[model samples]
Target: MNITIKGKVPPKAIIGVVILVIALALFLLKEPEKDDLIEISESDSIIDEKLEEGDLETTPVIQETIVVELAGEVNNPSVYILTKGSRVYEAIELAGGLTEEADTRNTNLAAILQDEMKIYIPSKEEVKAMEEQSGTKAGSDYIGGNTTANSSNQNKNSKVNLNTANSIQLQQLRGVGPSTAEKIIEYRNKHGRFNKIEDIMNVSGIGEKTFENLKNFITVE
Candidate 1:
């Protein structure tokens, strides 16, 4: 003999199965990735901050030009706004005037000016032509350029007393020679300090014209 059995689910079991199916479907259709949501939130916050601020303060950039003051031995010493290629002489012109003792003869007045160059004035004796004339006229057989020979010879003949000369002391003066420079030194040693510049004339070969020329560049003190 054979026996058969039939089974039917309860109403609660069917309801629970339906609820689980709904939950699984919701999870499968979820919104977006967590990283994407976080990125969207940060972007929205940044945009909100920008919109909240009405205006932003911006710093201004300024370009500046420099000006310098020049005085001392110059025709017109004063404050000058120099361009890129100004020279020493140009600055000197800004100042009122140069002292009579200013030694400009050695200066390359035509030379370009640096950032802070001091253009000094020259004295009468520092660039005297007499020494040049004496050297040229003393001997006409000189083969060098007529004008150049005279100046060259004069420069060669002129000697400086290193021990006693000032800034202008090394300049060429009339009748100055190696012997004269030595004599000037000897005098300074024997007689002590020179109270006056005129004492240079006391040395042999330093005539009145030489002394006059030297007066501009020389100082005893």
Candidate 2:
């Protein structure tokens, strides 16, 4: 159909059509960029959450502890806080170790310490005098050592000599039992002799309470 409807097209209608086409093109181009921005935001959020979780996992935990009271012959004798399973040697180190007059012969440095336990270190001269009074030869009757002895003779006063007392004589103390008596003798034999009645508490199992029960019946002489 060759219909010649000449004249010019409407300028307003052409301008409107062109504007609609440009707007459609802009929307199409911006859609992918909007989606990309959303994806980047989601990824950052995920990374932040993971970092927070990692921080929680890497936190440190504190260890359990025990309190022990140290006294006698140490440089600084006071109550000390120690980690559980700490040894007697460690406790001594915390208390500034043994002083010049400290006699550590009866101290079980390797023994694992208990909470509220007290340690007493005797003097060297005190131990020497006790050994002399007991007339105990240096190398005789060593517990778990080479020499052996006959049954110990009790003193006239009925006090057990911490230096020369055998297991049987040690058992005569008020609170001393078969095991504790053996421990006393072993301590005496291994470390020379008890310097004073208080030094008996330096043994592994003996504490302040045990010392109280046997103190009156025991003597270093």
lDDT of 1 by residue, 185-206 (tens): 4454344456677877776667
Q: Which regions of candidate 2 are displaced past 4 Å?
A: 1-53, 57-62, 135-221
1-221: candidate 2 lDDT, tens digit per residue: 78897899899989999999999999998776778889999999999998988755655788889787676677998889999888778988999988899776644677565555555554675445444544222212212222222323424356666775544446556677778876776565446546789999899898999888878778776
- Reference-based lDDT, each prediction: 0.51, 0.66
User: What's model 1's lDDT at 57?
Assistant: 67
Error of 1 at 3 (Å): 93
Q: Candidate 1: where is the Cα deviation over 4 Å?
A: 1-69, 96-104, 125-221
Q: Candidate 1 at 144: error in angstroms?
A: 33
**Most accurate candidate by lDDT:** 2
